[model samples]
Target: MADIGGVNSFRSFARSWRRAASFAEVIPRRPSFVLAPEGEAVDDSSDWDMDDGRSHIDGSSEHSTAHSRQHLLRGPSLQSQGSEAIAAEFSDGASDALLGGSPSTRSSIFDVPPHLAAADVIGSHSIRYGTINSVRYRSRPSVNHDSPWGVHDEQIDPEAAAMTFGEDNPILVKEVKQGDKVVLTVEGQSTLPQSVFNSINAIIGVGLLSLPLAFKMSGWIIGLFILTLTAAVTAHTGKLLGKCMDYDPSIVTYSDLAYVAFGTRARIIVSALFTLELIAACVALVILFSDSLSSLLAGFATATSWKCICAALVLVLNMIPLRWLSYTSILGIFSTFCIVCIVIIDGLVKKDAPGSLWEPARTHLFPSNWMSVPLAYGLMASPWGAHSIFPSIYRDMRHPHKWERAVNTTFSFSYALDTCLAVVGVLMFGDGIKDAITSNILRMSDYPESLTVVMCIFITIIPLTKIPLNARPLITTADVVCGVHREHAHGADAAAQPSALVHGVRALIRVVVVLVLLGISILFPAFDSVCAFLGAALITLISIILPISFYLKLYHKEITTRERVLSWFLLVIFSILGLVGTIWTFLPKQLVAA
Candidate 1:
C-alpha cells in the first residue's frame, strides 16, 4: 500500500531504513546489489521500471541514511531472532495493500523488524539484505549486454515470487538468487493464431506469384521437389534463428544474434544483407506495380504514368508507421487467398476458352542450361525471402518455443497454396506460365466479366497487400541504420524516443530510398532479372548459407558428425546454386537459352 516496491519507493524505503537506524554516515546509492534470500547477491538492473531504462536504486545507502530519522522499537535485540521475514510485495498487488485495506500492510514505520539492514550492501557490488515492511519488485533484464549468451537470471512469475526461501522465511516476492535461471514467458500481447497468421503473412510474398514459373523451368517433378525441399530448409533455418535467440532472450533481431555468434563483422554482414534485400524488394514491388497496372490499363495510361502512379502509391504507403502496418499482412492473407482462387479460375477458364487468354507463348519443361535452376530458386527464394522477419514474429508469439510450429505451419499453408497454383498453371498452360502466375491469368484466360473483376482484384490487392509487408523490412532497417528507435516512443517510456532531428533523418532516408527504388524500377521496367539475381545470390546465401554458418559455428558441440557433414554439403551445394544461378540469370537470353 505504501508503493514501497517501486524503484523510487525502494529508494524511499532504503532512505527511511537508514533514517530509522539513526545512521550518522550518509551513503550515496551507487548501483547497490539486491540481496538474495539465502545470502546470494545479484545486481539491480533497470528492468525494475516498467518503461524507463534507468535503474531505481542509485547512490550510496549511507549518504541516503544520514538525512533520515530512526523508526525503532526500544524493546528487543532482533539479532537474537533465529529467522526473519522480509516481505517483497509486487508493484501489481502493492497498491491494493497500500490503500489501507490489507491486514498485512505495515501500519507504522516501526512495524519493520530490527536487523533490516542485514544485506552486505554497505560497500560497492555487495547486496544489503533487509527485513522490510513491504517492498515491490519487477522482473530483471533477460541478458547482460556484454555476455549476452551467458547463463543469467530471468524474471519469474509474480505468483511464483510469493513463495518463501528455505531455512529462513524472508522476502515476500521471490527474487532471482545467484545461478537461478528462468525462461521469460511473457504473454497477452498477441495470440497464437494471430502469430501463425503473421508468420504466414511474412513468409508468403511476391514469390508465390512466380512459383509456376519455377515449376515450368525446373520440370514439374524437380520444381515441386525443390519447392518442398526449400520450404523444409527454410523452416529449418527459421528454427535455427530461433535457437540462436535462445542463447540471448533479449535478442529481437537476426543481426543481434549474428553479433552474439560472430561479433561485429557478422552483424554488419547480416544488416547489409537485410538492407539490400529490402531495397531490392522495394524495387521489385515498384516494378511489379507499374508493370501490372500498365498491362491492365494499356490504353488508359502510358508506362511513365503507370510508374509515377506506382511510385506515388509506395510513397503514400510508407507514410504509415511500421507498427500500424501489421494489418496489411492480414490483408496480404486475403490477397494471397484471392490469387489462389484466380489460379484455380485460370485453370478452369482454359477448359472453355482454350487459347483465349492472350497471344500464346511457348512453354518449356527445362531452361537451356542447368544454370537456369537459379531462376526457379530466385523465384522461390527472392534473395533470401522473408526469413529476416522470423525473429520479430517469434518474439511476438505467446510461446517462444512454439516458433518452429509457426514456421512449419506458415511454410505448409503457403506452400500448399503455392504448389496448387504452380501445378495448375504448369499443367494448364505448361511452360507458358509467366514469371508471375497472375500474368498467366491475364494473358491466357478468356473468362467472363465477373472473372475479370476477380482477376483484377487479385492483381491489384495482392501487390498492394505485399507493398507494406515488404516495405516493413526496409523501413525497419532504415530506422536501425539511421540511429533512431521510434518503436520505443510509442511505449510507456517517452525518454526512449529519439530526438526530432533523428526522426527527420529517418523520414528523409525513407523518402530517398523510395525515390531511388522508383528510379531503378523505371530504368529497368522488367524486374524479373533483378528478382532472379537476388533470389540466386542473396536468397541462396541467406536461406542456405547463413543458417548453416550459424548452426555449424554456434552449435558445433551440440550437433553431430552426420549433421556437420550434411551442413557442409548444403553450404557447398547452395553456394554453387547461388553463384551459378546468379551468373546464369544475368547472361544474354541467347547464351542462356543455348
Candidate 2:
C-alpha cells in the first residue's frame, strides 16, 4: 500500500511540473502582450493557400521530406498563423534584428505601441516624428517638412502644407484688383472733382467780378513781398534739406535738421522751440475759433468754450505718432493748395469787383495790409518753408539730383499763388484790405454760409498738423539735460557722450524763448501786429539769417572772399531790416489787434 501511494504522488508531481513548463513557454515574460485576445485569433492558412490556388502539401514537399528524413535537416521555425505562439516568435525575431551586433543597430519598431503603428506609417515623412527615417535616407533632417505632426522634419513639402492650411484662412488670401487701367475710359480718373471743375470754370467765365468771391484783396506790393519771401525761404530750406540728405539718406524732420546742424546737443533746443511754437499756435487757434464762433453762433458759442475745444483738439493731434502727423501735413498741403487755387481762379476771373478785395464793404476778403504780410509770411514758413523738415524730404526723394527741381517747383507754385492773391486783394480793396481779410474766406464773404465755414475750418486746421514736428526737439532736449541724474545713463559709452542732458537744457532755453514770444503775442494781440512782428522776426531769422549762417559755416573753405563778403553783407542787411520792420509793425499805433 505504501509503494502504490508513493507512485501516485510522483505521477501527480510530474503532471504539475509539465503544466507549469507549458505555461512558461506559451506566455512571454514581458509585462505586456501585443497578440490578439485568446478567442479573437483567426487562422490565415486557408486564406493564403486559396489565394495561391495550390495544395498545402505537394510532390515537391514529398521530395524535400525524403531528403530531410535522410539528413535530419533543420529549417527556420514557422509559427502557426494568427496564434499567440506565432506572435511571440515574430516578436523575438524583430528584437534579435534590432539588437543583433552593434547597439546602434537597435530600433524601436518592436517597442512601438501597436495602436499608433498606422499613424506612424502615414506620418513617417513628417519632421515631428520622421527624423529617424530621414536620417536613414539622407543622413540629415529635412527642412521642407511643414506637417504639424512632423515640425522637425525637412522632407515634406512646406508649400503644399501651407496651401492646405491656407485654404481655410480668409485673412491670408485677400486680394485687391485694379479698378480701371484705361486713361480715357468712363471710369477713368479726372484730376479735379466735379465741384472744383465747375467752380474753376465759373470763376474764369466771370472775369474780375469773381474777385469778390475769391476774397483776394491784399494788393500787388504785399503780394510781391510774400512771393519773394516764399521763394527765398523755400530755396534756403531746400539747400539745407540737400545737406541733410547727404548725411542720413533717410527721411528726416525739423528735429532731425536740428540734430544735423547742431549735433545731438541740438535736440533739446529744437524740441523746446517746437513745443513753445505749438502751444502758441494752439492758443491762437482757440482764440480765433472762439471769436468766429461767438459771432456766428451767438448764444450757442463762447470764446472760452471754443478755446477749450481747440486746446483739446491740439492735444489729441499731438498725441498721435509722428508718422500720422506727417500724413496730416501732406493732407494739409493738398487742402491748402486746392483752396489757394480756387481763390486765385476767382480773383483772376472776377469783374467790377470792389477796388482791391481789402476795401471796407459788406464783407472784406484780405486782412489789413499790416496784418496780411506777417500772416501770409507765417503761413508760407509754417508749411512750405519749414527748414527743419527739409532734411527729411531731401532724404526721401528717389533722385536726390532732382531735389532742386522739386524745390523750385514747390516754391514757384507757392509764389505764384501768394502773389496773385495779394495783388487781387489790394486791387479790389485798396486801403480797406485790413478790414476785408479775416481768419477765413467765409468771414470775408457777404453770405458766409455753411460751405464757407466748412472750407475755412478745413484750411485752418491743416497748418496745425506741424505742431508736433516742432515740439519733438523740446522733449529730446529735456531728456538730455535732466536724464543724466538717473541711475542708468544712455549713450555714455559712445564717442558722442550724453548730449541728451545738454539737449534738455537747450530745450528749457527754447521754452523760455517761446514763453517770451507768447507774452509778446498776448500783449499785442492785434492781428496786424502779430503778423508783421512774426513775419519780420521769425521768418527773417529762420529764412534769411539761418540759411546764410549755415552756408557760411558749412562751406567756409570752399567759398571765395567776395562770396564771403557778400554773405556777411546780406546777413547784416537782413538783420537790420528784419529788426526795424518788426519794431515798426509792433508799435501800438501801427498794430492791427486780433
Give the clash count for each candidate: 34, 57
Q: lDDT scores for all predictions?
A: 0.52, 0.37
Per-residue lDDT of model 2, residues 1-594, tens digit only: 323544234333332222111111000111111111112112333322221211112223323223222111111121112234334544553443322333223222222211112222211211111111211222233332322122232232322322322211000100111121000000101111211221121111101212222233233344445447546754754565464333322112444334334433444454444444334443343444455554555577554665455444554554564435534544444555555555544444444355323332333343444443433444333323244334433432323455566566555554555545545555545444442233334445543255456555654564355434344334333333343311111123223454666556654554543444344434545444344444455556655666566566545665689978977887886677566666665455535332
Supply the TM-score for candidate 2: 0.48
lDDT of 1 by residue, 459-498 (tens): 5665565565466556554554444524211113323546
Candidate 2, which segments miss by more than 4 Å at Cα? 1-219, 222-226, 233-237, 240-284, 341-384, 434-440, 448-450, 463-524, 589-594
lDDT of 1: 0.52
TM-scores for the candidates: 0.65, 0.48
For candidate 1, report its TM-score.
0.65
Q: Pick the candidate with the highest lDDT.
A: 1
Candidate 2 clashes: the total is 57
RMSD of 2: 33.7
